[model samples]
Target chain A: MTRILADRAARLLDFLWSGWAGLAALALLFACWQAGHETWGDFILPDPLATLGATWSLAISSESRGLLLLTAQRALAGFTLAAFSGAVIGIIAGYAPAVMRLARPLLTVVLGVPPIAWIVLTMMWFGTSGATVAATILISATPVVFVAAAEGIASRDRGLGTMAEVFRYGALGRFWFIDLRQAAAPLFPALALALGTSFKVAVMAEMLANAGGVGGALARARAMLDVPQALAWVVLAVIALVVVEYGLIRPMQAEIEGWRRAAQPWGVKK
Target chain B: MSAALELHRIGHAYFGQSVLNSIDLQIAPGEVVALVGPSGSGKSTLAHIAAGLVEPREGRVTPGYARHAMIFQEPRLLPWATAAQNIGFALRRAKLPRRLRPARVAEAARLAELEPQDLAKYPVELSGGMRQRVAIARALAVRPDFIFFDEPFTALDVALKRRMQDLVIAAAEEAQFAALFITHDLVEALRIAHRIAVLDLRGRGIAGLRILPGDPGARDEATTFALRQRFLTEDPLFRHIHDVDERRRP
Candidate 1:
């Protein structure tokens, strides 16, 4: 028990330390943004400070915060739907090669149709509502998760399955203990990608459909030619993406794949 | 008493090509039998069949033991789990209470010569030999009445292989369990098995069976070497044991 607690503590520390690197990367992006603002002048690209000021003002307002929350809710709801259904179908297809083969063409077709096209289609179907935004995110994000999960399961070590069989682990036990554990290594990354897609698609759908969200706010800023406000909203959307990815997805990945960290030597940890 | 395992006329083929045919073998309780064959000679297929990992295309496998475990050529340890967790996984099948599982894992780790510190390490953290040790501990933790070894130590260095064979001999003696140990190495078979059954090159059947002198662990190094030498040089049944048929799967 003490060992587990100590390990968890160590991982927490490691994660916190890695945030310094993230901060450095963000600083580099800020430098690039400052250079671009100077090069293009205030008309085309707003200075970093002006955008920050706009971001702070927007953040302090209750209406803009509600809009951000609404967009996050729509994205998360669509992501949850996609993740659950994609994982289930993918796992079943993974165990059955014929099913996987049949799903491959369909996955390609779904992937080939852009998120914008889905937004247009869904806007027509749901008529410019939250459901339209959610449906677009769902269609755009599920393929990535499905493909990753299928590949993960398809490529698992068959030797482990035989070992489980020898030990008399039932079908359910083997699936739970061996198959799912192996599949998780690939599944987590796909989930992260799908989440990013969900947010992007949600915002795109909201903008195209003229729904009320961060995307809708951005549309209004564009109509009024409020460049700094539009950039600020974009920044807010990115911050939300980073929070969901690092805060939720990464921690779950670290917990599931702790053994991978053990495999690395001390110098390789960072 | 009934035999611990009985494989009657076991026949199996992959993709319409027969790899094992009419193979008959039996192991009495507390006996260690080595099935020796060349690469791609269906030794592993037969072991898998007897262990119920594969369904025989044309025969019956009657396992009289209470429970059985297997140690494959690779460690086959769950890379995501710690060594202790891997061993504890097998104890789950034994239906030991959850509270007692740690102690049982520790006991089996000790039996496999795994140290306390090593039990907390994942399989990827351990060396190749240590990973195989974890696999052995996993098998031992189940307290199986029978065990199947499908070339469990072929990947190890010579010294490591000897140490692993000694560990198995010691564990088998202490537990008095029956095992079907499949190997291509005659010395390994001589050192660990009470009886060595030579499998035919073409997978027709068990070519012959030889009962070795003395018990498995009691045999000296010199005795094992000489017996292996005699079997390789003089025994006609072992002529194909070293022969590799290039066409078949290794």
Candidate 2:
């Protein structure tokens, strides 16, 4: 039908339009790379197209796919665990100011310690295993989610609680439906940030600890002084980050916040 | 039948300053009593006391009947809930069977003049009038024996206010629900209330009560306007109210 075709066209337009800003940023990065390429002459930085071709080949290869998968799996596992624990503790802390005050110092200390330091400590304990990579990511990302969820819970609309009470909605019903709905808004942006952190920490841990992932592959490329290949692995990791964030997280945000679409200027009522 | 609600010698104070002093009022079954007062006359505090929202320091409320509800000045709808879901929330509290909730919500929505398409929209998606209608629908969904109207239509425009008042009057008649309507608008009080109970601004308790003559919710705009003019001339509170209005009307 013409309607179906029109809908598909509109969706395609939306998809392309959403990527325009990212494309512009990538163009800027490429320009910087071109300047360096012109200066170093294919030894230090290499041509952007050479790195793009290397990334394309890496994308096609089974070994590189496995390395990408390993890194993704570790990052996601750590993020899931952190999200669960952080939301629980953060919600409790939000309701109890004493708990938040007590935890503030500890949270600052944990967040201030760099991911590299956590990687070193985790490596000493887990010794170049996937566990070290997961541990490092959990440490680096959990605090961001916790702080966001806590702040969200603390600042939720107070009228909703009273409204729920007037309706005589049970305690559990009020908490799960009303309280959680308000908290989820801010928590989601923090979650996106944490997911990015998880990826960064995972790759860093893999390279430093010799864990088998994209970071390990990047280490191999670095030792061989294959500039394009090294850039190719970096590009592949970034591609993974962009794909997960845009593909998974963005759609969920759109669905939950769909009510805002109605707030847009309608111009004329239907 | 027993009285629907009774407030016996209710007295309250915030930080030792008396807001309500030995306030007493009663609502018979199916009666609509409007509580009228100027700002800071403890009209809201008395309404809250009657609804058991805030406990009266000196007396008590006897909510004799089951399934009472309140419609506040603000819509106070849960933003996350769709219109139908918000109505369904009230049905749940009314203890309708889970399977029957959707039907009852739809029926209440019909009574409140909410369209079916609006049922799926969240509070943020609804207009100011539509959101108030949703709140009205939620209050009426339970088919309650009593409802407290705490100046619920103040935010609405004149047309919307009339519409909402009509809905409340219709619901009150059809369900025979007792209501304690609170407002500063004398015309609105006259429109929806069977009798007006005026709260004294210079003091803490009710000053007078006036009963109106007519079938409630009947579209007698001329009759209501006549009664409103009489109130402006005769009622002390309304005369005081008119003096303020007289100064402002240029």
Candidate 3:
């Protein structure tokens, strides 16, 4: 019973160490915000409590809540479409040299074009709806994903591939064991970037399209010249980005990286 | 026993340069043939052609064996897989059912003398000799009719090398699998081979083939050492290699 109590105490210490570290960092950030509000005055920076009140009020409103959900839906749809299409094309371009040569120049052109330039054309085509926002996000995010997937396939170990061939690994086996494993290391980071970019592009596109979302809420706040309300909406968007990134994408990435680390020299031995 | 592998006047070139020219060889079932020469003497190229990993520019290779596998100079174990998993990879597509796969992997591990703890460890966690043993285990797990060893024990220490040599002889005796072992080490060739072929790089084909009169299984260190000395001094076919090395010495 004493040993069990000791084990529980040890685990509790580890739990406190991990969980409290984040809370401590958040407290430090709030302290800094409070200090800045006092120094900069209400016009430039709102008090922490006042900002929290505004954020809470805006968060509960029907229109603002709907806008947040709509933005999230747009981002998800665009990111999914981009990830799927990019992965397919990337795998083909990575494996086949002839296809890569033809596709590379076109992808470069697409990557180089600004998101704002594409917004005009997308708005004209889709007419300021969810489709227009999703299209903008897709156009912004696909190239980064494509480049990462192609590089991952190209850098795979040829020896392992040859070994796979000797074992008569059929198409599915080859892809699952060799191709996908090789591609995974680079693909995860690209997915993270694409996910983040989709959110930014969706919100930007929504703002310009005057579509119903957080961007539309920002527009209404701007029309009224309510600086604190506008700031609150911007803060909410940032919080959403952080939550999606750290809470969702980051943990998934950490899981993959942990698997990779275990497969590496030091981690496995330890 | 019939010939398990037959190569007739096989020729191969790399980027307009002839690496192997008019090479002819044959290995009977359960026979162990060792090909020895200096570096870049086309021994590896011949082995690669025989393994069907490379295409010959001329002549034909008739593979009478049903299955084949190779152990390269490096262990070439998959870094992502554990030792047991690496060996099991060879059995992944075999007709063996899932229930028997783990047993087969365990048997191969036992044959290779790998510890249970080592079996769960990744390649990077293993020593140089251990990794090579894992490679051998992987090859054996496939239950191939023919196997190729391309300087597979080059990186091992003397004791580890001798142990691996014994393992190969034992495995070959038990399984009756023909092997084409390539190496520059005359001592290694004498310890493992039934017949030794000297590849003549200057002459563009096999210069000499000597069938050793004794069994590899019964040969002791004295006999192996004697054979090694004979290969260096008395073997006319290997004189050129000795002379080249002597000239290159500072």
Question: Where does candidate 2 clash, by residue pair?
Answer: none
Highest-lDDT candidate: 1
lDDT of 1 by residue, A1-270 (tens): 896798789889888998899899989998999999999999899988999999999889999999999999999999999999899999999999999999999998998998898898999999989999889888988888898889889999988988898888999999999999999999999999999998998888888899989999989999999999999999999888889998899989988987887777762222
lDDT of 2 at B99: 87
What TM-score does each prediction get for chain A alone? 0.96, 0.91, 0.83
DockQ of each: 0.65, 0.41, 0.37
Best by TM-score: 1
Which regions of candidate 3 fall more than 4 Å away from where they truly are?
A1-28, A47-63, A231-257, A263-270, B157-159, B242-250
What lDDT tens digits, residue by residue, belong to model 2 across residues A1-270? 795476447655766886899799989999999999999898888899999999999999998999999999999989888888888889988888998998789999998998899999999999999999888888888898888888888888866766676777777877877888888888889889989998888888999998989989989988999888999999999899888888887768765754555555751111
What TM-score would you give candidate 1 relative to the actual structure? Answer: 0.97
Task: State the lDDT of candidate 3 residue by residue for B1-250, as single tens digits.
Answer: 6689999998888888777878888898888999988876778878888888788998799988988888988887777677898999989876678889989898888888888888877777788989988988898888888999998988888898989999999888887889999998888888898999888854277888988768889888888888778867887776765434423322
TM (B chain), model 3: 0.94
Q: lDDT of all predictions, in order shown? A: 0.91, 0.83, 0.82
Worst 10 residues of 1 chain A by lDDT: A261-270
Error of 2 at B88 (Å): 3.0
C-alpha RMSD of each candidate structure in angstroms: 1.7, 4.6, 4.6
Q: Which digits, one per residue and each the tens of the lDDT, describe model 3 over residues A1-270? A: 795476447544654667788899988988998898899988778877787789999898987777888898898899999988888788888888888898899988998899988888999999999999889888889888888888888787777776776676776888888888778788888988998898888888888899879888788888898778887887788778777777776666654444345554445352
| Model 2: CA > 4 A from native | A1-40, A104-106, A124-127, A266-270, B15-18, B55-58, B97-99, B200-203, B218-226, B229-233, B236-250
Selected candidate, larger lDDT, 1 vs 3: 1
What TM-score does each of the candidates earn? 0.97, 0.85, 0.88
